[model samples]
Target: MILTAPVSMFAMLMTYSSNGSSSRPWVTPLVLFSLPLLFASLALRRAIPALKRSPQGSGDRSAAAVALCLGGLVYALALGPALDNVGVL
Candidate 1:
């Protein structure tokens, strides 16, 4: 989970083509990839007593936080507006 976040982030970053015609934006990919890490980290924390307060969960927690924030921004600025326009919000 921790590893996937970076890979996904890099993958998304690479899409920002010089011609401004990237296949996908970084925000969506970052959030989508980070969510699973977050869940896995939480689950690991619960499953292992020491992981709750140890560094083991740090990566996942941080990634999750980042993803959530970016995802929220994207939803609010892009998805939400589009949905609202169609009366789906």
Candidate 2:
């Protein structure tokens, strides 16, 4: 929970930052799409633990699951534009 939130925001910011002209345009998007898929993976990490600890249908588990799914979806959706910005796609 603590770790995933900041990383999610950072990934989106990096994705958004790629729209601007930089000396090395690939850097931001590259960070956003780093190996091991840290951004979305962290959200999954948070969700898994919450799922184990919280009871089924509880608000905490539900919120964590929703956060993970939505975060992954947003990241997946952003990838095309971010890649296209650097001509990688």
Candidate 3:
């Protein structure tokens, strides 16, 4: 959900801004939606083996390299505040 997470977040932000509402129940689904991406990342690490490597590696899993890290960071940053807002953190 490297693409899906942020796109969904941007869409929600745009919707909320237009309506001028400070509240957003729409954001909660993004967290739930991220589960599949998380599992897929883990599965990729296990199946590919190369994806878990360091800079010393010769063979790299190029496709997953940036997207996984970037996606996880974005998901965490967005999810943390959302959870805290709902008193779930």
Candidate 4:
């Protein structure tokens, strides 16, 4: 999950940079990608205890998923200036 977040953020940044002719085109994709992560994170938070009780690798999986979602959000906000500089709305 952590890996995917950075990749998604990078993809968003690239999308913003490459689509210079459009205004705010990045918003749709950003929201689209983010919404799922947001909901997944909420669900994870709710399921943590149940997940912790699960055998094997469930706990690690949950942690990684949470990390990825958070990292993606952080990257999106952190990379905003680059996006705007590249012509994002």
Candidate 5:
């Protein structure tokens, strides 16, 4: 779940970068690729509390936090660009 977020973010970044000259081309790919990222974020959100409750999961907790923040930042960065790319903003 944690790993999938970055992978999806990379896919989105690559697609958005290489999508020159295409019209309304990003909607489909964005919808398709965003699913994994969304799922990863949801899964990580659920896991964080569980990780905090377990003594052995201290490392896992930090890893999840980092992954969550990374995913969130990517989402934040993508928002304006995506809206601009789609001409919706």
Candidate 6:
């Protein structure tokens, strides 16, 4: 999870930074997407024992991670359109 989070963050940052001379509409979505994963990761780290003890906890965490990834993709898609209209892309 740690590895995945950093990679995902890096990808988002790269995408954000790569948009030259304009803002990406999807930036909000990307930020929104990353915020949850960041919080979840922190929560999981702080509650490692609880997560380990719960039989279904791992699945829950995986689901949350997947959701975050989907959010990022959605953001990426929306970003272009958003930027096109707002003159930021």
Give the C-alpha lDDT of model 4: 0.58
Residue-level lDDT tens digits of model 1 in 1-89 = 45566776666567666676554454544555465545655644454553344464577556555655654554455555345545576
* lDDT by residue (tens digit), candidate 4, 9-73: 66657556554554545553454456455665566565566555656676666675676566567
Candidate 1 positional error at 9, Å: 26
What lDDT score belongs to each candidate, Candidate 1 first? 0.54, 0.68, 0.61, 0.58, 0.63, 0.54
How does each model score on TM-score? 0.29, 0.47, 0.36, 0.33, 0.44, 0.35
Which window of ten consecutive residues has the lowest lDDT sum in model 4? 19-28
TM-score between candidate 6 and the true structure = 0.35
Candidates 3 and 6 compared: the better one by lDDT is 3
Q: lDDT tens digits, residues 23-81, model 6?
A: 54455444544555566556545455544464675776565556556655655664565
Which pairs in model 1 have colliding backbones? none
Where does model 4 exceed 4 Å of error?
Answer: 1-57
Summing lDDT over every window of 10 consecutive residues in candidate 5, give the lowest-scoring window: 19-28
lDDT by residue (1-89, candidate 2, tens digit) is 34445665565565555565545554455554564356567888788899889998799999998978877886776577677767888
Backbone collisions counted per model:
0, 0, 0, 0, 0, 3
At residue 80, candidate 3 shows an lDDT of: 75
- Best TM-score among the predictions, by candidate number: 2
Q: Write the per-residue lDDT of candidate 5 for residues 11-44, one digit (tens) a residue.
A: 5565554645554545544554476567667866
- The CA root-mean-square deviation of candidate 2, after full C-alpha superposition on the true structure, stands at 7.5
| Candidate 3 worst ten-residue window by lDDT | 54-63
Which is the leading candidate under lDDT?
2
Q: What is the lDDT of candidate 6?
A: 0.54
